[model samples]
Target: MSIEHMEQMETLLPEWLETSRLRTGQGEVASYIPELAKAARDTLGVFVADSQGKTIAAGDYGIPFTMQSISKVFTLILALMDHGEEAVFYNVGKEPTGDDFNSMIKLELVEPGIPFNPLINAGAITVSSLIAGDSPEDKSQRILQFFRKLAGNDGLDYNMDVYHSELETGDLNRSLAYFLKQNGVLKDPVEDVLSVYFKHCSIEVNCADLSRMALVLAFDGVDPCNGEKLIPRRYVQIAKTFMVTCGMYNASGEFAIDVGIPAKSGVSGGILALVPGQYGIGVVGPSLNSKGNSTAGVHLLERLSKEFSWSLF
Candidate 1:
């Protein structure tokens, strides 16, 4: 039952889709953000890309959604690349919070304002401030450019509607930024950082585009499409290690045990999971389980990893 030995993985997914799609029936879409609540609850999609940039998918794979927290991975990598690993880690730690993504209790409990990891909202905001740009516009443009390179799609840009929606209700995040500022941990102003952070989160993409972005991490930052070194190799290993250990908020450890793939989950019900140097999978089902991850997503990935024997451990 190894993916390498499986003769027809490309043919098995649709049947799996039919059987697995219904797992989303019981879960609910994230309603915290008014825009996020509008996602089609039953809209399930899966896209996978191999090392050679080949792909296969089923269901609503082409339907577009915001990158949400999944953008954390790319931005973290970009910050590391521009500032060097040592500089970036000074502001963010590599540990998981075991709390909700937007929780603020940590900033008080973990003094001096170091974010536990870049996967969480507080940590992501800290990471965004390290992107090596002096201005918000410069920093955001740099983030989008890096994304375009990894996704092979220059058309990527922030969904203004989602950005505004998030910005309007981002009280907790604003508090987190101010906390960092008080401790001298934040490099940019809170207003500027929020602008960059919100824009990155609002960047739109479908499952296919995300799978390709995962492909960059799969190959350790090398864009296999054109032999371009899109991200530094060491930075990617760091990002992937965090993804495996803490990518799914509080459920990260369980996801690692069950799925055994280096993966990241966004609030938009999208999971970007990849097998290093082999393949990458993108799954989206807007209905979230108690862990704030897609309900069917956790189950489907566990089954796929077990059947295919692709555990990193």
Candidate 2:
């Protein structure tokens, strides 16, 4: 089954990538973060990796970018592992807000005020406060180490330029952290929490790295290449559920309907998606549609899912 999937991907990926890249022009590169806006709007890349580390790739697969909001998925898992389900859920709820990922509207309006889900900016900022560390730097190091382990790449690190850019223009996230603190939902200092959040958001990765990370989740917490369990099964299940329900921001429902996969997208124009027990896929396209997903990347996944019947639905 894996061989057949790889064969189909190798044969069909080039054409699919070309078709998707055509949609890049219709979307705009994210400009709120100055460094993110520099990404080439027309570039598109796709990489699919199997359990054994074999891969098939097309387009700008080697180009590196930050994980952005996609990093939130793992951070939520890390927090769950650190604090367990009951404590973690105390600070964040488990429903989609149907608002912008970074919007603070519900934080103000909702009583007893917890962010709707850990995948949103408000909830992620709250989660960052839960990471086990004595200081913000300590927390950031642990997150980087955790990400490196998941990607099976020891050299993984943050793109500092992007990190600084995020910090400079992150007034909204800062506000979210302060609000969470005021609501007694976050225990850490606001800047410390934001520091941890921004650091993880700037972690650099390419399509291949994301494919390896997704492969672990695809196998339900086990690292397919080493046959080792990297995350608890329950935590993996929770993460995948959020990926299906909220990973693409407001367009998650549309993505689930059209592409039918458990996936998370980043504002850096990258996406991490998986075909459970089958393939781990990664894509990047700097141009974004109104919903903040990679425009070309979403189209490419829709095509591949349709062609291979990869949808969970």
Top lDDT hit? 2
Badly placed stretches (over 4 Å) of model 1 are 1-7
Give stretches of model 2 more than 4 Å off: none
The C-alpha lDDT values of all candidates are 0.86, 0.94
Listed per model in order, the count of residue pairs whose N, CA or C atoms clash below 3 Å is: 0, 0
What does candidate 2's lDDT look like per residue over 10-51, in tens digits?
Answer: 998899899889999999999999999999999999999988
Give the per-residue lDDT digits (tens) of candidate 1, residues 221-262. 887778888888888999999998889889989988888899
Q: Considering every candidate listed, which one attains the maximal TM-score?
A: 2
